[model samples]
Target: MRPLQAKIIADLHVQPVIDPESEIRRSVDFLKHYLQHNPQYRSYVIAISGGQDSTLAGKLAKIAITELNAHHTLNYQLIAVRQPYGEQIDAVDATAALDFIQPDQTVTTNIKSSTDAMTLALRDSGLIVNDLSRGSIKPKMRMIAQYAVAREYDGIVIGTDHAAEAFAGFFTKYGDGGTDINPLWRLNKRQGRDMLRTLEAPKTLYEKIPTADLEDDHPQLPDEMALGVSYDYIDDYLEGKNVPNKASEKIEQLYLTSAHKRHEPVTIYDTWFY
Candidate 1:
């Protein structure tokens, strides 16, 4: 792994630099670069799950929209989408998300059919025992639905993958991890939340435990439970706070174990040279 990615994965939780203005500039630069490079993605489709991460990403997109226009008025669209899995947690998130970004601009699409297809495919492959335990199926289904929406609206997919999640590879590669642009890639969880607060995001989103809303009974299971620790613990350890012995140990283990996920695939590129 690159030293910076390793250092962040191991210890990046710290007090924020507290420059809201700087954050805005950073976000603007990121979005401008992405949109400029990917001109086909003039419109943006954000997978807003109403958690702090996505909420903050949505806020940043709004800021980027204006900032982009200020530099030169351009005709572009920002779509805040809620691809619900029909879970109660997701339903609530979808409802709350509309208030934050407004549904007229945000499309709430239920992806139960896609989720069902994934379960059936996994079951046939013997990778899944039953319908309810289809963990990997959900994110993939959600991605398909979001991308369909993005294509329908001629937009590019946007996501909120912060440094911590990226370090841990907490997201399903090419699923929720797939995006044309990510505004929060460099920011840690706390920094993402702080940016949302700067944009005055809804209190519900800010306070809610982060989850991907895969199952109603296991709304929190899809993400938080899988991580084996909350972002708070992860962030605190990264920031160099004194964590409980168990949490400290877990943090160290996670950083070590997930280090491979942060790097390029090991390859025989040197075979020809050798």
Candidate 2:
């Protein structure tokens, strides 16, 4: 692998050691500590989409706040927000995830009305957005909903981004990617599954194919097929495991092309931007 790519893996801390139990405790502790320090925040909020990343995160946040409530004077809650765009196509999966988390409270913000309004306004103004661009709007709308809840409750927004997604830059920038905390940043897809197993989350949550569920025309397309590199391949690459030459080259190229997503929006001070 190229040195730059190797450096990216190292920086993400995707090691071969798989310690789900320890990682869970560490993440829970991390959340508790952050909330304790920032006493102004009364809770941790996460948008659970019935995916492994969000499921694990919601579980951790619940554990953290539950522990804090029991032991500390201050009361905190883990608010699990379900931001469905119209009727979420995978409503069953999302329901199962919410049941498993059993968060202190749950909030559902149907983004369909908001998303449609934006699209309708755009068309009225003699402009239109393609499917891919329209899909990005959902995540941003979801984030807006999450922040609204967080602000209402004096809480923090927790993101589900992990090493594999971060390296692939598969997230919508300033959308689902915008958050105050991420407990799974060091983990990859496989590692996330291991954590879910440790948490005893519903097996189906991890077993089902992972999809961004973004593009309307292609509905429910697997992320690997969309990205042109399997999660196993991405996970292997992140974990420093050797893979086919073509896979490595393609993964490296993906890292290069998506570099912009990995960083903050460029401004005049960004020397590379001009």
Candidate 3:
């Protein structure tokens, strides 16, 4: 009851049909406008994971910085951060994304050492930490690494959260979900790929299956399989297309269960009655 599912599509500003080129221009223009208003910002820091969301975010950020430099003679920078736990299974795709983004700066910070140290400290304190719990830490660590880079550069951390993911509350709270601004907040996953194709993005990066891969035991698992529902269905629902009752129910259930992720931390003054 916290979030009326009926109002979600409108709340997220999801347009069922969109012109990729127009959306791309709009997002880029929004980024430029944001920087113009906030003159103190220096760079746009993005985590390039070779996935559709990050790849698109990075591409748009690079374009923003590049255009600012070309037109306004600004010294803006685009910092692309690569945070892999140990060895990324799809390093090739990540490389390809970086090749496409060609960010002004690329920072590779392997979070393995820090991830392991936290695990050890917890275990030493006589607490039992499961693999799934440890796996969840990777995203938080990656976020930490990104923020560290942003803090050092006085940059704004760009987030990849879009309507579909935000509607389902699919991101880890304060982890992959934490960011300064969301340029892709109104687009869905399919719309994101459409923009990518319009931008002539590498076919491999957009075509590659998206995975959180938080389960160390099961590496490179597709997001649809892990979520128990397909992106097509989520997109359909977000687009206001009629979907099966079962799929709709599952989507709503996911949204309800993960509702806390969508809000700030609860406080004593919070009102829960609905």
Candidate 4:
């Protein structure tokens, strides 16, 4: 059984050429609206990695701040942060994104020690400790940094994880996968790319290979290699089409199996409804 099957309820097939401008607009609007309506959070903290997904998310957040400032004249500010583990392009991307947005606050932290701590904690757990899980240690460390920054700044962590990653279970639980707000939750990679293009994000970000920079000089994992199928094929199967190839079949099964992660925990009701 694959993880993807249980997570997806319906497949909405959208062509690449389809106009996603409206979708982008709606997503941005929703995030802004949520911020305005929710009084608990004072600011928004964006984890800027300079990848297309995070870059796009950061741009949209900037636009939201601009919109709110224009109408309400609030004192809210966006905070751009980078948590560098091993040496890689992540910090470069984070710095570039910070320059682009000129966040009201910026901070960088060396989280290698924290990464080690997380790896040890995971080892104590009973789950099988594989390379992928070990690789997730850095992300867990970054999540701790983000949460600390969020508390200090009276804000919440914003994320760029989209449907594709969620469907594939590519993120670490309570790590990079956890966020106070996710503006890209509904959008998949293709839609995310479209939004990035629409927002005129940096070309380098779009062109750069996707790497999380967990390990020093860590190589980026391709979607196919990581998930046993390509994102394009997963996207197709998730959209309800009968996936023909063997790769697609395995991907579909994995997606279905991982569906439980996307939803709230299931619990037995103490009392039946009348």
Predicted structure with the largest lDDT when compared to the true one: 2
Better of 2 and 4 by TM-score: 2
Best by TM-score: 2
**Model 4 Cα shift for residue 17 (angstroms):** 6.9
Tens digits of per-residue lDDT, candidate 3, 21-74, equal 999999999888898889888899999888999999899988988899897866
Model 1, runs deviating above 4 Å:
1-6, 9-16, 70-73, 102-104, 125-127, 130-133, 215-217, 222-224, 264-266, 270-274
Model 2 per-residue lDDT tens digits across residues 3-122? 766887887888777798999999999999999899889999999899888999999989999899999887788899988877778889999999999998999898989988888888
- Model 2, global lDDT: 0.88
- Model 2 regions more than 4 Å off: 268-274
| lDDT for residue 128 in candidate 2, whole number 0-100 | 69
Q: Each model's number of backbone clashes?
A: 3, 0, 0, 15
Clashing pairs in 3: none
lDDT digits (tens) for residues 1-274 of candidate 4: 2344433624322333436688778777987888888877767887777787778877788878777777875677788887666565456676677777678788887787776666677678866656666676667777888898999988878987777777666777777878888887766666677777776777777766555544333466554565676666766655545566696667666665665555555567423211
TM-score for all models, in order of appearance:
0.81, 0.96, 0.95, 0.83
For lDDT, candidate 2 versus 4, the one ahead is 2
Question: Using TM-score as the measure, what is the rank order of every candidate, best first?
Answer: 2, 3, 4, 1
